[model samples]
Target: MPSALGEYFQDDDGSLPEIELRFAQPALLVAALEYLFGLPGAYDASRDTACVWNLIHDREEPYRSPQDARRVASGELAAFHRLLRAAQVDGCVLPDLGVFVSGEELILDYRMGPQWGESEIVALLRLLARLRKRGAQVAVPWWGESGERAFADAIAGIDAGRSAAN
Candidate 1:
């Protein structure tokens, strides 16, 4: 549900990479992560803060500006913080876990920062495995006959209302 995804710096400038996923149940996403990673890959309290790619800030270390830090007060952001804390994913009040949404079509997003690597995406596959276990519908936009295109085509026939034209 978090659209307009971007990576603006303290000076408000950026075009970094990001990730998104749709799951049926919100908690199931965490459950999936916990089932696979054992630590709910979203937030590790002992590590960082502000999950959504750690809340878009300067790419450099100490990546917080006065204005950016103020966002910690937003209701949406604060709710996510609370959820992680309650889950005991970490002790940090603002653990920079990944990002997520538990709604009609549960969505998970991640802003791959400057240091992203191929290995990081392996975690996503774990999520796919967990989703299959829970019977949650997945919408992966990949390629080839066995990729995103075929998945979309298959769903488009069964659930035209939910499928995209593309």
Candidate 2:
């Protein structure tokens, strides 16, 4: 089975925008790209639901700090390089290509599902936390009706948990 993103990307109509593939692990990069390009059973969406962890960094002032931006950019690049290397060892293929940045934000896009298991989800949450620490806003783009419901449920669960905790 092919992943949802992989199948979508392969469509001739080109519905999706040109996304820059970035990662903290090089191994994931290779696997993700390979799966996107159709490497014969490279990805399985039913078994692998993709997660997008977006990091949004906000600036209070109109003046941007060049030094801070440069540092962020450097960190992003380093993370991506490491991700690429990790993907190679894990038998994961890189997406056709990807973009790199540091200060802007670190977005982690991954496909997960039943097969990914709880451990994977925990890992993803950790990654989200890391991005959040860097001042990025994390979000998951819901697809169809089911996806929307799932996201809603997730939010509800979090809200309920927070209320109970308080």
Structural similarity to truth (TM-score) of each candidate = 0.35, 0.31
Question: With candidate 1 superimposed using the best TM-score fit, by how many Å does residue 76's alpha carbon deviate from the native?
Answer: 15
| Model 1 quality (TM-score) | 0.35
lDDT of 1 by residue, 1-166 (tens): 1111111111212332222344454455445444323443333332354333333442333213222223333322221311222121222121123433333233333334533222222223333444565655665432223455544453443343331222
Q: What is the C-alpha RMSD of each candidate to the true structure, in Å?
A: 13.3, 14.2
**Clash numbers, per candidate:** 6, 37
lDDT winner:
1
Candidate 1, which segments miss by more than 4 Å at Cα? 1-97, 140-166
The superposed Cα distance between candidate 2 and the true structure at residue 84, in angstroms, equals 6.2
Supply candidate 2's per-residue lDDT for 165. Answer: 15
Candidate 1, residue 102: Cα displacement in angstroms equals 3.1
Query: Please, what are the lDDT tens digits per residue for candidate 2 over residues 6-57?
Result: 2322334423222222455433433333333243323333223322222344
